[model samples]
Target: MNPFELEAAVKAAADGDASAFAQLIEAERTQMLRVAGYYVRNHIDAEDAVQEAICRAFTALPTLREPKYFRTWLTRIVINTSMSLLERSRKTIPTGGAEAEYLTASHKDTDGTLDLLQAVSALPPKVRRVILLKYMHDLRLKDIAELLELPLGTVKTYQNKGLNLLRTYYREEIEERRRAVEPIAADSAAWEGKDMESELSEMLHRSRERAKTLFENQSAVASAELKPFIEDVFRHGDQVRELLFIWTKPGTEIGISVTLSPDGDLIDYSVDMELYTEQEKCLHLPPEELFAIGERFVRDHYPDAPDQFSALEIEDRGDRVFFSCSQYASGMPLPRSGFWIDLHRSGFVTAFKYFGSKPEPVMPDHILTPEELLEEVAKDLSMKLYFMRLHESVHSQGDDRLHLVYMPQPYLINRPAVPESGESKKNAQAKDDYDPCAGANEPILEVLRRNEPGVPADPETLLESLGISEAEYEVLREVDMGSERGVVYRRREAVPAAEAVDSTDPYTLYRYMQARNEETVKVRFDRDSGRISSFIDFREETGILQLDDRACLEIALNLLHTADPFVFPHLRLNLEEEEDKETEQPSRQNAGFNFSVCKDSVPGFSHHVSVSVNRTTGRINHYMSADLGMEELEKLSLVPSLPLEEAKRRLIAALEPRLIWELDYSDDRSGDGHYMLRYKLVERESGLSVRMIEAHTGQIVTDNF
Candidate 1:
């Protein structure tokens, strides 16, 4: 629908026109499902969330301030509803049995589809939500921020972090598969005492010979209308023991290579064919001219080539040029489907090889509208949340409190509790005095109550008095209290005074207060809600032992295990960097050890754990770790709700054609402009949006344009 039509419909819907409301809902249904699926694991739940959102939107339509923002408004409602459902059902949702059965019945597996599904499924909910909205729905980063009510920076972080996680996981999986097959392959006679290069050469030779015969027998050029004959014997090499033969006709040429082993046995061979050539050598051809040459070559040789081959790229190799082009459908490049044309310095086409099969036109027996396809897509959507540790620099004396913003996309309600009115000033003035021998057995709240006025009732008692459910809050107890000496407590406003706190505030501070012998405690509780946010304990040691990198790593790993028991097996020490320069006295220096979570010890995963230790003292100074909270993810099913092929078809069906101005730079330094036709899938009313869908996984691919 055009912008005017959509705006009119939205206006009518807001005016209490039921049919118009339905029309708006129907138009945006598929998009809504794509967004909702990012929060919920199954289509059933996604549908439930979207259904609830629709009901809520209809009831609140009259309050919509802008008709043009109808899609964004409805999307926000869906996100909220989906998150609410996920939060409520996180603990009790059953795993893969019934869902697996349904998936098995509805979907047939395709290449890389299952792996892509698993990788995405394992991402954290917030990261997954960003991935879906940005890639699956083709929403711009800014649009995603607006939809999820997040900062644009945060959305970008999620995208990068999520993709890094996916890449790491995929690499690990590939390594595992390679490891699994290595033992068997190593024991085979064909591999025993043979170099890999030699084995590959032999295999390629056999494959190429077969390919040559097949081409000669069945290729279009082999027909009687075009009789080609051997024209030349290219340079034969003795070092490689390879022979090259060239065949030519009026408008076509073919080259073949045959390699032999030391024993004169066949090793490998390759065939290259060309349909166009230029006899004159042009030392420097403009990029436009190069592009024109490629275009003309393809049109003359392969006139029936599909529309997917429109995207092109030209690489200048100084001695020659290589043109690599791919076919695109629905704003995405088709996998492995295109041609590679090599142009020599003489401007003659040297080779043309169709690297992938021609894509069959997708013509579904019945075409589903966007609304109908939304139902199908809902069945395939999955949601997951990952935990990422973002570093924020602060003065050592600034507030140590971790302030979390509640993002609806990930469905985390981490709002800082607002201090009660009229009490902010009093709370701000309260000071915490550090006593190494302060009350050990009493609750910290009780200690606070004894030390200060205006301390509300005991936290548990206050919650009980307020009739709040204990289960609503998850108390993270025994967090670390970093090593910092001095007055541990400071009375400050429990609420943050601004969106961002000034670093130089006199009262802003982070310190350690003794809770018991050899121990310190830092407690964070919502002053307004009377619920605990986190409680961390630090143990103080009197003696320091000399240690090395290995010992430090062992201690760091132990601490990591204590912090998160599940990550121990997957964690591997990735890097150990020295933080201080060597001295003549050989005194110990601080060192940082970084650990990454790998599936089977394969590297390249993001660093999840960082431990800082006093290398001379053998004491761990500080450490931090992040994960996708996989324990929660493990409880949910990994089975997709929809089939891969069906999802692709549905995505394609929902795509809307758009005109885009593509630029072709001139090869000469003149900087002349050339325009070409290109198609993009864009969100309605968005500014020059170009949406790309991954052909294999049916996910959107975001690009810088």
Candidate 2:
């Protein structure tokens, strides 16, 4: 299927279309099993591992943010699942295989492909993963890094090691066969028929089912594969178990630490739960200190108490603190007006927040002096940040920082909890019994012989071969329903561009928003420097805009169907017009970019936002909430860990009279940003919002007109 169809199928699966998902999975299971068997040497274990991975992938289906990475994501999950299975295994499996059509026409040629497959199947699990990825898929080092979430250097290392092992193994195997048939060696010309590369490729592409079938039929199957499964599954399980525990249990082992400025002042503090391992050994703060420390910490140490103070989950170890804040929820949106703090163990803090100004009905129990906030979270940040800096020292220069992140095995400090006593003894007994991860120094050739498949294509060529339908492709176009067209068509040379003036509401409240409506929001943001320099968009609209005594709420959704929003060769947007809305001028101009904007208003609360557009995708790349001051921030104790919907509800309660406008400036390089219009609704009050346009273009530097 083409990308669009795949995306739609993914979306359907996310929405609970079990059948569609099953079909997609069934179509790819053959490949999935091959890959799984390569990473996991035991055929039975490999089968079990792939099934488990598929189930997890299906359950967490919605978490997939990008459809294009589907295969890669699935590959990672399968690898992870196999590793997990290995960890939990007590005894390792001994061998594996992939299917081959043993029939050759006229029985004339003994398939060389089988020989090639045998060599690959012989390599170690780790080395095999690299080989299959490199040869079977022919992906570059960097792409493999993204797929596996491993470093490019590490991938390269595996590639080199695996190839060298294969070369050494293939030579030894050839010699053994030659010794038995000395005539072939004497007539070396006849033996030139053994093609090592072809055989290896076939092995990498071998079917897992075939490998399994071979193992079941064999008299003695090795047990090494099971050992790896035991090792990996338990290791993986432990990490997952810890995260869930931290998320569900409160104050199980809370601890915090702080780094004092030589001047003994606070710079930044973070709240984390991975610090203190033993709650019993953790520092226990005397009650009196909690109340008393408030004065000096906020009033004297951070005179900017109301401003610079930060409060988060802090491991309250009497003197040696640990980390975290009850970010589960904020009570209110504190006006950027006053200072508020809280003092409590995790459960209290997690259920409610205060740094973003939460409720402090009872000062002693809930609220703390500004000083208390600083004392709590700084310790946690210091520890986590210190480790981060150390890692940075090692890999900081590897790549550009503007769009990529380089984090090594996210800061792991809390020692993994020992499995309960009984399970530990049981696992020990199991460990003494099996050896599955290693199937011997299995000749790379024999392993490959078991799994190799028939037809093969290069990475790019294969995707083309799957080919999706054109009709489905059309539904994938990028759309912008927010065009301020009245000014363009009615007032310009051709037709009326704007929808009939929003009789109910129109206009933007933020002064900066005028830039979106006027097509003059010049934005210059440098990723490396982290700066928003300028943004602009201008449009002339001829319609009655009745916006007063009200606020507006508008949302514009740009449906994207292509990887390159511009020059999208396969798709186009379809817009349905409403009779109630004003007649619009149909033109070749805004046909590609379709926009949708909605507006409404409320009473007493003041809020407004404006967005800009600069590319064919015409999507709002970022949004700066209009009134995100400390007062409101402090009340956002509910913001930290809430689902997006819960966060929105809390925001609505806290920031009532607010306006947020968003526009898409996908590419400044193409002044084509000009023809794109993002729609919007400006609200002045609780129930008041004006429908309008925030067309932004011509603010970017592009090589072409």
Candidate 3:
């Protein structure tokens, strides 16, 4: 069938038309049977597998995300069905005359191809599947990984191992039979037909032309002084896309990226110091010298920049140091209006970012003192339990796990409450309830305790919750959602992208994926730590299931319990019915329940599991868990060393506000906005210059952004 006809048939099939599904399957029957034969070997079993796969596909047709990829999706289902059938029967009968027609249909009826197939069948099951998918189906390694639900690295390993075994088993005969088909070496004479150097030169020329064209389109706003710097940076860049120019060394990760505004103004410039590669290494220069270098750069590039921008603070990060300067007006630094230079130990200026076009505003004559500021900000200061995810560190031996700890927040000063209206109520509520702290902390593992690890959910139980029977639907596609530091485990329904899977629900990921292609349930966990980090159910309803809110909640709760029983007791349903009533936007049609983790009924941390249930089938179409593991929770420092009153006292004592000029962009119609004088909280420890306070020994742990 042609592409348009096939798509129409897929659409018709998705709408419960069995005839269209039959036509779709019939057109690809020969190819389907051949793929099935790779796993089952015998003709009878292959045909049975194909028939069973067709039945399953017909039943699950509506769940398909992309109609155009119908054939590829059907082939995947056949492969899975065949493997499942083989596993159940444990039969390894050699291929006979009955299967020769199906097996040799595309192999040109060659004995070498038959020999190769037999050799592959003799190999290990996983390796054999990899080889068949890579060569027979002509799929990329990544595609094979997604098809088999294995890691791309693991799939590549299996492919290489299978090829080595094949060479060892049939190297001599294959070489003699197909000498001309051998892979050509880099220096082979076969490449002499093409001018490689000229081709590369032409490609380079085209890339430059594209870059020039892009630059010219926005040349009206381009500053004359910025031309030299832009040319120097773009000269080393390999790619110029839109306003972003990126250049990375071929073999090394050392690179730099520059982003510009639509009007050709600089937005951001950063260096990717991948473990401080030789080219990007810093000289470890003194702070004084680094500060001088920053000032000199500003003096040369920005006229009067050295006079307008004053040094605020310096942060020493062992390998590199950051010298931050802010646009000063009336001897006070403006909040969120500053540029920081990253200088390496090698004395190299690794990064230079200019936050420019200083706003002219009337300076505030009077600023609130620490005593008066304490009274105003004291009400907003409070100690709350926080779930902080640690960063992967070698010195501290951190494993990037979540840890529950006490943290202090100047809520009013740091983040003022905003009025929510219309469709923003749900998003506003989510932000208020689950604003994660920015940056990771290096946890001292030796001082912290560890809890007994809980068992992960059984693959069978997870399937059962979705109304999928283990006996009836035996194909378990294991998806390797890559989590390097944790165990990766996934089991989901085998449905490809179908166009009819669109969703209008804001809470559902169907809308996030844009519903243009691919939809499937994916459960991913850290590979080494074996902790569940994410679980998303994107499968569309099959019209065979339906339930109410209680039933949906029960299903979600049951699944959460199966995943981690200990965490189950601490979870409470986060019903936002009242919040939804205030919004003028369309009410949510799907049933979604967010369960927040609480200790003794106090909701402090932002660890929750959100489940989206389809209103039509009552089956969970989306499930996301950002909760910490029970073992990680056991390591939490529940009790604070300082009393709440004492913590508040310290917070009050540390409170100080500086008067500065800030641009007001509440209703920014034009690019230029009027500036206003504002009072911003500053840290007294940094001489009332910086905005961050040093963490107390056992009081305020960290600031939540």
TM-scores, in order shown? 0.23, 0.17, 0.46
Q: What C-alpha lDDT, on a 0 to 100 scale, does residue 692 get in candidate 2? A: 12
lDDT of 1 by residue, 224-337 (tens): 233322211111111222222223344432333333333333222233323322323445676677666766766654555434465566667665677766665545444335
User: Candidate 3 lDDT, tens digit per residue, 628-683?
Assistant: 66676676555545566665566556656655555443333222344566555655
lDDT of 2 by residue, 302-382 (tens): 455434333532334333322222212133222221333333332111111122232332112333332332232122111
CA displacement after TM-score superposition, residue 422 of candidate 2 (Å): 48
Model 2 Cα shift for residue 251 (angstroms) = 25
User: Worst 10-residue stretch by lDDT in candidate 1?
Assistant: 508-517
Q: Return model 3's CA RMSD, one decimal.
A: 23.9
Query: Considering TM-score, which of the candidate structures 1 and 2 is the better prediction for this target?
Result: 1
TM value for model 1: 0.23
Q: What is the lDDT of residue 341 in candidate 3?
A: 68
Q: By lDDT, is 2 or 3 better?
A: 3
Q: How many Å off is the CA of 507 in candidate 2?
A: 54
User: How well does model 3 score by local distance difference test?
Assistant: 0.48
